[model samples]
Target: MSAAVRYDEVEAGQEIPAVDYNVRRLNLVMYAGASGDFNQIHWNERFAKMVGLPDVIAHGMFTMAQAGRFVTDWAGDPGAVVDFGVRFSSMVVVPDDDQGATVTVSGVVEEKLEDKKVVIGLTARSGDARVLSKARAVVQLT
Candidate 1:
């Protein structure tokens, strides 16, 4: 909840430090249960492979949430977020293993707007795949 940033203090082109998150089959299972998105591609490896996916993949919404978390966490107060959106660019393949998968999130301040709002550009990657594209958020700062 402590983003440690303010609109007045931020400047466009400033980079937010990247963060890495671990994703495992178990995590996907839990996400599936909580989201009621029991898509086989998200849990059943064989089914996912049968469908031509590399393996059981993380839910698109799940990956989107992760990016949302990255943006909101940087904005400090979640309520500061005025808008957010992204287009899914690639799948996050989750292999069943202790190593799991690593999702790295990074961003930069893209622009400043009226009403103490700042636009942030976000990026998310899992392995070599860019999981999200055109990810952006607008946040109102105090």
Candidate 2:
């Protein structure tokens, strides 16, 4: 899909609606299988605590992907994102309950660049801690 955001229509400091993504034990299990990252800290609560984590934590890549989804979803196309990066600031502790955990992502148009590209600044939080930091995406808009 092509980007639905027109470069001429967006301005710096504009806000994008926040999106909350659910992270459950099942989802982590699936990601571990697909990504070949079978680290016990991601799915085994006991193991996670034994390893000094608060609880079973979500994979760093999984959290990053969710944040990236927020940007791609806003641009209306995954391919429109020419660059994306983030630093894992905190762990998303996933409990074994039905409610699991929530990762809330919010974004802003940080700057407009040449060639119809824009820099989008992103923040992702879970519980009281920010899960991702320095999250940004460079998107090519039509």
Candidate 3:
């Protein structure tokens, strides 16, 4: 494990390294099983199309969880996150192919909060669409 990030070391505008997260159909299936959110749009392309979606789209909560993972991993402790939220700006279309879809998540320290905390603004994009907007997390650091 890496060392914990000290609160004093980070500054506003500092960029966190980006990480690519893959979301395959199988992953969606697994998530659906685990989360008990078996929404047809998440795994059924035909049903999704019938519902007016271009294709089988990923769950918004799933995308939010991945974003949460990005922040918690960076903070080295999931419990460090005091606040996190996102708006589903766009759907992440997942094609039934070998390559699947990739969600690239990047973040920047946007503000230094009181009491050894920092507000990090996150950006998540898939294909040409911005999937998550108004995404931010408050993490407590040593």
Model 1 lDDT-worst window of ten: 1-10
**Segments of candidate 3 deviating more than 4 angstroms:** none
Write model 3 residue lDDT over 45-110, tens digit each, in one string.
999999899999999999999999999888888788999999999989999999899998999999
Tens digit of per-residue lDDT, candidate 2, span 1-142: 4358889999999999899999999999999999999999999889999989989999999999999889888998878999999999999999999999999999999999999999999999998999999999999999
Structure candidate 3, residue pairs in collision? none
Each prediction's TM-score against the native? 0.96, 0.96, 0.96
Candidate 1's residue-wise lDDT over 1-142, tens digit each? Answer: 7855767798989898999989999999999999999989999989999989989999999998988888878878878888999999998988998988988999999999998998889999998989999999998888
Model 1 misplacement above 4 A: none
Local distance difference test, each candidate: 0.90, 0.95, 0.94
TM-score between model 3 and native = 0.96
Comparing 2 and 3 on lDDT, the stronger one = 2
Off by over 4 Å in 2: 1-3
Error of 1 at 21 (Å): 1.0
Sorted on lDDT, highest at the top, how do the candidates line up? Answer: 2, 3, 1
